[model samples]
Target: MTPLNRKKERLDGLAASTAAPAAGQAGGVDVMDPVDPVGEAGAVRDAEGVSLLASAWRRLRRNPMFIIGAVLVALFILVAVFAPLLAPHAPDDRPLIGQISASTNPIPKAQDGFPLGGDEKGRDLLSRLIYGSRQTLIVGVLATLGGLAGGVTLGTLAGAFGGWVDSVVMRVVDVLLSLPSILLAITIASLASQPSQWTVIVAIAIVQVPVFARLLRGSMLAQRSSDHVLAARSLGVKRSAIVFRHMLPNSLGPVFVQSTLALSVSIIEAAALSFLGLGNPDDSKAEWGQMLGAAQNLFDLYPHIAFWPAACIVVVSLGFTLMGESMREALDPKSRR
Candidate 1:
């Protein structure tokens, strides 16, 4: 071979030899593929990077508390949704006076196809409870939404725009926070020109607004200084886009979890307003609290009437609480499960 050919061959061999060990090193580690921290970090992040909602749902399904809550809530929802179908009797229908003897008293127990028997007004207790679930759920859910809508608007503006706006908003929030929620609700509801369902919902919603507003504001403030938000700012994204599209969406996990909890509170508040004669006073409507209030006088003679509604309120409230607590746990980054 010519000297040039030999030199070319030698160079090729040298290059192959240098590349071989790097490709298949003794320790099984790749010398050619040195660790790139940024790339590795990306991988690690992706590995942990399921969407928040999806991750929360996964955890929720597995959590016993969530399962229990979901089941109770679902059952209640079904009962509420299918109230008309499920109620065997008209909620306001009274039993035949002669059919049920006077000796049995106004409230009967576990007879005449009425499993839970009759209320003071002789309406089927089970039927009333079933129908009442509908009104309770409507009030609870609608009131919570009202609060959430108002609160989100106030909180987003206050947190996203800081300084004087935030100061004014937070001060108002503080004032609201200082008062007892129930007491404030009572005051507001009582002040209404006519005590009705709307007043009760408005009162409960007004009480909840400060709670959600403070929560969202704090969450937003914390996220506003975060790396992603700063990056969005650097990219010349509009403040509105960064706040609504980025910061708001990211900070909503806590709000959603709290909203579930707030539903239970709203239910209780609405019920209390009704009990206090500030809500629907129509005895025919079959509201749990109203039923209880009507039965209060007869408690000594027929405690069973109060028992059913009270139990319902407790169980439904507990269900929402468990759901909220489970959500809080699932959303927390530090939680192993």
Candidate 2:
């Protein structure tokens, strides 16, 4: 045979041999079995179910800062939950009323019944401190939830439907962001004809709404242009699914971190409002901020009254801040190493 015919024959024989089924196979090839052209399909399938939050949690498990923060937050929550059980006396009870005379020190020193001593009003200082954690937690969590609801709604609407919708929402956000957080909170608190615990919560929530909305909006915008979003679009996935499933879920990492940080800020701001005489109207209620506010005049004479609450605030805030920062690091791909 000529060289060309010989080459063609060799090629044809090679193709026939390749097409032949193996000894164990029933057919030429398993047509039903899906092809994994790149050899990465198994790996992709294994990883596909893992979400960002799950991955972040995995990272957080090994993170020392996260552990410390989580422990502190847990203790704080536990103290708040068991305030009634933990506290030796009722928050409003004044058992040592007779001890507070012009001759005797208004604030009592550590004694048998009161471990942390007594406040000016003769209420158990330790009891109030424990109960104050509950009040503080309530304000922080509720305010954050309220703000989160409003912020998420505005952010989702702005991001999912850009153009004029984005413009109007952004304008409102801008107006809110323009004012300083404390100033804004003060203004909102002032607007309330009756200043109560709810007033403080609402004020803080309003201030935080803009912060969360802006953060979520920015994250959403970035997600909207991501490869997965583009792929979903090309695959003719519904826009709602893309926004809700792909974009919003992916964008919440930063928001969650911000929420953690915001809790600390809310507590501090609540204290500030109370200090400014805009907190709960009830003088007998046990709140950390209110306690701090009440101690202002007595701060110089008896530092422990102010010191205890302030220290609690600082420690608790530090815990939340640490947790938030760790979460941010965990969520950031660049910080993974």
Candidate 3:
């Protein structure tokens, strides 16, 4: 045989030998070769990613602080939503011809249907607190959402379209930043005169917009230069589409964190404005701030008058703050490390 034929015969023999079944087996399958080293490594990496996410979820579930915060927030929301049904008495009902701050007052009893005791006006303190939850939650949630919307829009525009647009937008932000937030809110509230709930919402939104805008701008600036953004650009994607669809989704982590923190601050601001006699001027019976304002008078005579309302405000704000911190840690890739 020629040298080439001899080489081919040897290769065929080697393949047949490799495919042969073990001795004593009539017809057994051939043993498969081990997977490629690179492919095996990739499979291990994919498995590790899934395991990491599961471990993170398990750790979060085991965290006592996060659990307590979540429970408190849930309870507060339930009470707020069901206040009218759960309250033992009408929030605005008062005793006949008696001041709420009277020291030697009749002790309220279930027989009298005043289970949680009465305020200086003889209105049920527990009832008012329950009702006040509705106002606090409404103002807090709405104002925070408004700020997030306005801030994210302006920040995304400024960051995506640098140069004169960015300069002008950032300059406007700086001007707002120079003003004291509370003072600016007070001025806006006063100018509106006997501000309604919507008016208070607008004022709080204005104060918060600058914060969101600044944070989003920073995030956008960083993301705009990333490899994926450049890759999208190279694929002939429109600037607006790339920014909104690709970059914005990646930038939402910081925006979510800021929104959570800002919600707590907005609630506090709503309370302050109401306490100063600026919010919901028409609806005296519909606000926690207004209740706090009323309670200031009976502070010395009936401290409980102010105590319950003030405590509610503090607890609600703290709940948001704690939730914000926990969410920030969870959503941030750096924090996971």
Candidate 4:
């Protein structure tokens, strides 16, 4: 036989040998399982490399600023949750009407039962501070949540369904954004018969809606042209799934960070509205800004009344700001060391 024929026969024999079954086995070669590239990449990225949350936690733990911020935030929340237990008196508690109305300073002396001091109205300062946290927390948390939800919804829709949807949503966002945040909030608040707490919340949330919406929109747009999104489209994956699952999830980190930071702003905004005589002036509720507003006239003589509430607002806002900065640093790959 020619050399070429011999080579061909040898190849055929090798293939047949490989294909033939062993004594107890079916016909097949021993094929090793293929590695899942996607899963492997996730393992590498998630377990060891750049997990957003895990690495953020690691970095946060290592950060002294984050520690301080976390502690302060924890304490603030504790005060809010346990105002009754922690406070020495009821938020609306006052000294005897005779003695209180009978004083020149009108500031309850920080002695006997009262510890921190008293406001112009004779309500316990410490108690008010403690209870005010609950209101502040309510406004901060709820307004931020509302804004986050609204922004995410609008931004996702705009980003996913470009063209007219994008234009309409963006135009609305632009209109809201065009006005200053405080101005927008004040304008909306003015529509209310009085600055009820809910009105303040609604106004702040409305002001924040544009900010968060723009932020999430930018994030969504950035991710829309990413390789993974295009790949998912090419694979004929459901568009809704790709948008919600693939794109939106990846775009949430910045929005989350912004939400935290905006919460701080939200609290300040709430306080500002109350300070401006725009919120419910219920002394029992002990809102920070209202306390400040009430004390403005008495500020010359009794600064502590103003000082305590201002301090509460500052401390909470500072804590959130610090934590938000740390989160931003941790989540942004470019900022990671």
Candidate 5:
């Protein structure tokens, strides 16, 4: 072969060898392959995008304490809602009046149709207990709602304005906080012309106002210094919008938890008021605390009368406490796993 032709043939062979390996390597793996969203890496991306409240809820659903608390709270609500259907007899009816003997058995023994027997007034105990759930639920929810409304207003004003406004609101809260809860409730209740269910609710609500106001104010203050709030301010967000939309919303987490805890406290406080004769004066309206108050005179002989109502109060309170505590833990960033 000629020298030029030999050199040309060698260059062609070298180029072919390089091109074959490059093509093989390009065909070996596809760069456009779709990712599996259900895989580990995808899961991590999803987790990173989850919201704080949503993450807290996810954790809450897994907690055994949360489950137990949820169940108890649900049960209480069900009982309250279905009280009319559940009570075999009218709560105020005293059909078992003949069964009672003041000197002997002031309260009737358990029997068919009347499983829990009769109270001091000879009213069907089982029916009264079932009906009491409704009253207790009402007091708890209304009191908490009232207190929350008042507290949120004060907290919002204080947190949003700061300086003089904060000092004024906090000083008022401090005064309320200084007073003993029960005594404060009593004083409020006494101001009313007559004792009624509403009196108990209002009294409890007033007593709780300070607690919620302080909590929300503190939370709002913390959020005011947070990155998101600062960013919103830098972006020229309106002052009112920043306070209500940003600060108020973020500050509500602790307040919500407090509301749950406050439900239990309200119930207990209602019972205390009732026991002190500040509850509904009408005997027809059955309440657990009222029952306890009426039965206190005969507690030595008919302990069961007081036992049933007191037990209901304790169980319901425990349910709220469990739910509130679990929620607090779930929402706390420090407690997150």
Candidate 6:
């Protein structure tokens, strides 16, 4: 063959040989063919979500404290909801005209139709406790919610838009933190023109806000630099939308933990305020703390009067605290191990 023709023929043959292998490879179902990396990654993410949920459930179920806490909280809620029906007598109704202090009168038992005994006035302790649950739960839950809302908003804004804003916000938080929370709450409560139930709630919420703000800010700061946040930002998402939709949702694990713990704190604070005469000033009100306060004068005489209310406070607060700890453990990625 001529030199040019031979060269062309050889080039064609090489091309053909390369094309044949490609076609053969395409026809052959190679079991070892490379997987789609994106699909595999998505599958891994779905699996991770399922596994995380399962782990959380397993951990919650296995935690005896969490179970106990849940049970206590549930019982309290039920009592509160059914207080009117379940309570044997009006919470504030003074049944006995004279002092019923250890008169050997047949005290009512729960099985005997009144399990919790009676106060000095012969008012039903069980009834008071049941009614008191409503106040405690209301104040605790509402105050925590207020704190959560205020803190998360401020903290997320500060962390997401760090600079002068962060400095200003954190400084405000620091200033609030400088004061003793109880003192501050008491002062605020005392200063209100007409303090009511909501005033106590507001006071507790204010005291709790700084704590929640600091915690949420820390979480937001950590999440702000995550890959998903960066990716969302790169997609031209609005700062507000990104902060609320992406950053906040991902950081809720920590916030939820803080919220649970904060509820317990708020409840205790409310009780303290009530015990100190700053909460629900109406004497006829049947709050647990108010009952305890009333019983303080008679503590030397009727210890049972204070015992039940104090026990309720301790049990409720402890339940929330324990639940918070368990939730924290369940939510913590590192703790999953």
What is residue 104's positional error in candidate 2, in angstroms? 3.2
Window of ten residues with lowest summed lDDT in model 3: 106-115
Which wins on lDDT, candidate 1 or candidate 5? 5
Which portions of model 5 show Cα errors greater than 4 Å? 1-48
- Better model by lDDT, 3 or 5? 5
> Which 10-residue span in candidate 6 carries the lowest summed lDDT?
101-110
Best candidate according to lDDT:
5
Ten-residue region with minimum lDDT total, candidate 1? 38-47
Candidate 2 residues 133-235, lDDT tens each? Answer: 9999999999999999899999999988899999999999999999999999999999999899999999999999988998999999999899999999999
Compared with the true structure, model 1 gives a TM-score of 0.84
List the candidates' TM-scores in order: 0.84, 0.83, 0.79, 0.83, 0.85, 0.80
Taking the tens digit of each residue's C-alpha lDDT, what string does model 4 give over 118-169?
A: 7766777777888889999998899899888899989998888889999999
| Per-residue accuracy of model 5 over 152-238 as CA lDDT, tens digit each | 999988888999999999999999999999999999999999999999999999999999999999999999899998999999999
Q: 3 or 4: which has the higher lDDT?
A: 4
Ranking by TM-score: 5, 1, 4, 2, 6, 3
Residues 109-149, model 3: lDDT tens digits: 22255555665555666777888898888998999999899
Off by over 4 Å in 4: 1-50, 101-103
Q: What's the residue-level lDDT of 213 in candidate 5? A: 95
- How many clashes does each candidate structure show, in the order listed? 0, 0, 3, 1, 0, 4
Residue pairs of candidate 6 with colliding backbone atoms: 109-114, 109-115, 110-114, 110-115
Report, for every candidate in turn, its global Cα lDDT versus the true structure: 0.89, 0.90, 0.79, 0.85, 0.92, 0.83
lDDT of 6 by residue, 219-247 (tens): 88888999989998899999999888888
